[model samples]
Target: MTRLPASCSFTQALVNVINVLSGIGLLTTPYAVKEGGWMSLTLLIIFGVVACYTDILLKRCLESSPGLHTYPDIGQAAFGVAGRFIVAVTLYAELYAACVEYVIIMSDNTSTIFPNTSIHIGGIYLNAHQIFSIIGILIVLPTVWLRDLIGGVGASILVVLCLLWVGAVDQVGFHRAGTTLNLANLPIYVGIYSFFYAGHKVIPDIYSSMKEPSLFPLVLILSFIFCWFICTGAAISGFLIFGDSIESQKHANKICSLQIAVCTVVIITISKYALTLTPIASGLEELVPSKWSRSYGVSILIRTALTISTLVVAMTVPFFAFLMALAGSLLTMLITIIFPCACYLSILGGKLTNLQMGVCIFIAIVGFLIACDGTYSALIR
Candidate 1:
């Protein structure tokens, strides 16, 4: 692909990255804050800082070659066709998992708002959660195939409003409970933090969109500073209100009319269905023959199959929090953190200084360890 036109201004690119970085994942951060108390808040800041640097490393790592539009292309350039295939598969797997989680979250929130919602077909009873996921798939089916992000700004606004509204309501009903946090939940908290900072998958896109791509570091720092304050406030405020009683999902707790807030979020999140699905669809399209890649029938079939498979997984697995944490541990650890460092080492070889090399090794080791512990905790709990 030739160099695309840089139509978006730097400010637009900054806001775009911010929107991608903060998604539905922020909704669960209250659980993390409640789990580790002040400790988790500190970790959130640390993670924010580390994320800024580590994600910049991804951009630098991609600098080893030009015209590398996607991770698979970079992988192929760095390694071989097999490496390319593996990277593509892993990226798509992560994306598909995310879409499934979205469906589950949307449906779960929908169910909470309407307790008695159910349907009976052929003498079988289905609750609101089950029905709404299917409904969600149908509603989102068409949007995913479209390649427009025109609704992105409106979606971001709704998400911010939902966060503030939920926090406001939780605070209004706030009552002090004896301070409590369990050490056992540290791994999960780390997982949540890792997941919350996950916008690395799109760094290449964000970088390419900027008019002054060389100044991406400035954008990274500024956006992260903004991210830390916003996320910290949201997390800590919710924790202060609910204390240790906060569940893995505060939205589902039916706290202080949270159901209504969740309803607003669910309505807003519908706009995001297409945004999340586009990457996965593009990944699928790459697997098809070039001649058939743009066939509308084939596109519909591919998307239909993708949607059904995701819905099936969502319905089968009710552990929303654990799954998100697991994705964070496994996908975020590798794709966002570990692999970038490893790739830098591989591409640059011994040209990097000892200090630079040591930093890469350190990040890889620490990320792997945290991911292992977090994945284990998510699985067990």
Candidate 2:
């Protein structure tokens, strides 16, 4: 059995969980909740329960497979190369698409935060979006190539403070904007709810990093509780803060754009860029032959190419809402609800009780239905 140094404490584990799970996904919660009206709350709770349940299931998966270092490893162990392919394609594609959207979102907010700016250098003018995009690339490039964690208690503390600031900022917006409480929007936002709570991809990494891996269940539970509170706070406060005026801000309040840029949006885009790119990069590394894996020049070239490709997409068809909705309903539903339950059943080899079987089928069905409608809704808009 191979064991990495158990350097992460429970507190560090908790903060890391919060940081990973809470990413830019929290930024969309308020607007999502507002979209489905009060009906969204009940859906959010339902999705939260499902998310927590599957998290435990995935943990059970790790316990069953000792040598698995990544989620694709788990998939391969469960169902061979096809399983691994499904995970790699779905997981990496989801993360890749998500990172691209963040690029657009970052640039969008950057323009708003620093709008109408034109800098002249060598008699050439640069737009604010261009300036910000270049800054984003420069800031993210080196970080993406480093293997050490950019996410930790240190970054997570900032995340928590920023979230609290968002809540407080929204509260002030509520008082100033005088948003009326209305719960009459259509209630088919289960996709968004599932997206908000989906954090299964990070579980295996966190589980491996722990001093006492057995205590991961506790961390998972506690982290879920912390995340749930912040999400609910953001959603409820934002409902009253932006209410009917959500269309103007789009993100849900006066400071939404600013918060999105400074808090976790760009940081997440930068930090997770490498994280999301890992599976693909690993594949590329393999193609380059074993001896070249340690070549710094090759690694930098790969990272730079990946970053520029994502930037290209971001600049092209930058449909922010569509991307989030797609990720939430289509991609997140699979990782959080469908795949875990499927893998669990496969591992048990049909030895489940009637209740166990029923629960699994039900959750899968719920996720499927939500993905369908959510995709449709996103496409139409």
Candidate 3:
């Protein structure tokens, strides 16, 4: 076997953690907090801890099973074919949901930038949704086909850009509204915070890439601390600047002078995320080999499909609150809450503590209910 690179450090591993979490969700953190309040911060802390603990557990499992290559392999080693199937299903579902959400966000933002230019298809005029979807597919195809790709550095660059954008927005928002945080909004804040901190599944992939897998626990602790601090700072600053009046602002119109800065950051950040998700859609093709055997062709097709579907939904749907809620409450829960513990217990074997089992079942149950509730709410409202 080829030896792993000695230069790989914990910081590099942490970069992977940052890369995975620094997707479109970062942009939505402020919106989620606006609804949840300070409770969002509390949720971040709680979920962050759970995420870290789960990471440690995953690292342990990876260490114990030397031959386990992918996550599905680990599942198989732990719980036979049934376990593999469960993990695969959950992983696919999570990725599918993530892709859908990304497409939706991109379409919405694009429409905001270009309100005119409609394409007439069937009996209806093609709107921003159709346009953006086509655009999204066109953009995502190329990046998906390359094997052994390393976009972590690119993602880091985007993260820096996003930070700068947040700084600019915070400055303008703060100047206009002053530096007061509304304590009454804690619950909404916690819910939103949870949304941002929900990228735990990527931890093992990060750990495996590290020079020393054993240090992942420490890496996770420090990384999450930094991420939480940054998120909290951004959230407080954004809310202080825009308050609850953000939606009323004209599309592509920055709410304050700093909004121009925010938009610049948003465009770069979104581009990076769109690029990152391309690989996920490509991976899906592996499951359906008959339809997607050609990497280049499938990648292009998936991206195109996603982009178009997202743009259509965005143009037709005036609001994204329901979609975001569904993504957060259901898909996020599957990846963050349910899968981790389930994989851990299966790998470890034997019996789990009442507390451990309880938490696992609770997350699954709650996630299912939330998904159902959100779906129903979306249909009704």
Candidate 4:
């Protein structure tokens, strides 16, 4: 592919990177801490390092070949059509899972705002959570019809500030004497931490849009470090405030300023479903003939079908944190960690020094273990 003109400045690209890294994962930090003990917080740092490294690997893969412009493109360059297919399917699955998580979170918070919400249709009964999940998706479904829009990153900052205010000014002291380590629950937190930096999928676009493409590595480093601090602060503050009783979506139940914070995230969650699913819908449209792909009716049908699938999945498995863990482990680990290293080694292995090859192999092994252990733990718990 011909090189596109670069127009995005350093600051613009930095913000875009942060926006991709920050998402519903912000709400689960405390729960993750509660699950694996305080020491498990280190996993966030470890995963951040691994994510940044793998992202650089992806950038190297892109730089090695001018034809590569996306994650699937990297896969194809490294292997063949099969590699592209696998990467595309995994990326789409991860995006779809994220949409389901958004529906679950929106429903979870919406029910908190109106606790008694419920409905009856014929012989079927729907509780507040179920009713709200349907409403949330219906509200979000139309946004997919409109193509161009951007997402937000301020939610991460808002959540951190809220956690601080509630703990410092509101008198929720940091007095919890949490365990130093709980090896039994370590896998769960590993998966949660992985989800925090699952932004590598979009790095190619960010790379191509950069006014200074060579500085992409610097941007990746800064974004990951920034996100790591946000996650750490939220984890410590949230655990200090809520302690052992802190479960997934725990912030939604807070009656103080955190309630406002939760509502803000809820709005973001509702708004993000369309942004998440649009790519998947477009990919499906591409599978059809060109004539049908350009038809508005066909486009709407694809978008509606994807939205309805997410709704069904969200309603079936309503556990927010668990669903996140499952997605992060099964899909995100591959997209963010395993596949990047694999592709880099495959595409550019001839140029790598011994140390570089060893490092890539080491990181890939660690990523695979984390994916397996985390996936099993998420399923069992």
Tens digits of per-residue lDDT for model 4, 179-206:
8888887777778878989887788888
List per-prediction Cα lDDT, in the order shown.
0.72, 0.68, 0.57, 0.83
Tens-digit lDDT string for candidate 1 (1-381): 112247657787787777667666666677776666666677777888778878777777667667775666666766779867777677777777778878877787777667689999999989888898888888788776665653343443454455566556534644454335567788887888888787777777777667787778888888877777667766765565666677674343343246555655565456666676677777777789989998988887887788888999988986777788898888888877787777777778668899999988998999999999998989888
lDDT of 1 at 108: 76
Residue-level lDDT tens digits of model 3 in 1-381: 012244568777777676566555555555555655544456667778876776666676787777864666667877889987877676656555555665555555665667686887778777775676567655654444343344343433343344456557444424343223455443333334555666654555566668777677788887788777666665555555566664411211232233343354345435454544554555566666675576566666765565556445545553444555555655566666666667777766455687876776676566556455544544454
- At residue 296, candidate 3 shows an lDDT of 65
lDDT of 1: 0.72
Candidate 4 structure lDDT: 0.83
Q: Candidate 2, which ten residues in sequence have the lowest lDDT sum?
A: 178-187
Off by over 4 Å in 4: 1-6, 171-173, 249-258
Measured on C-alpha atoms, candidate 3 has an lDDT of: 0.57
Model 3, which residues run further than 4 Å from truth? 1-7, 116-124, 128-130, 148-172, 175-191, 248-284, 287-319, 349-381
Better of 1 and 2 by TM-score: 1
Residue 32 in model 2: lDDT: 69
Best by lDDT: 4
lDDT of 3 at 211: 77
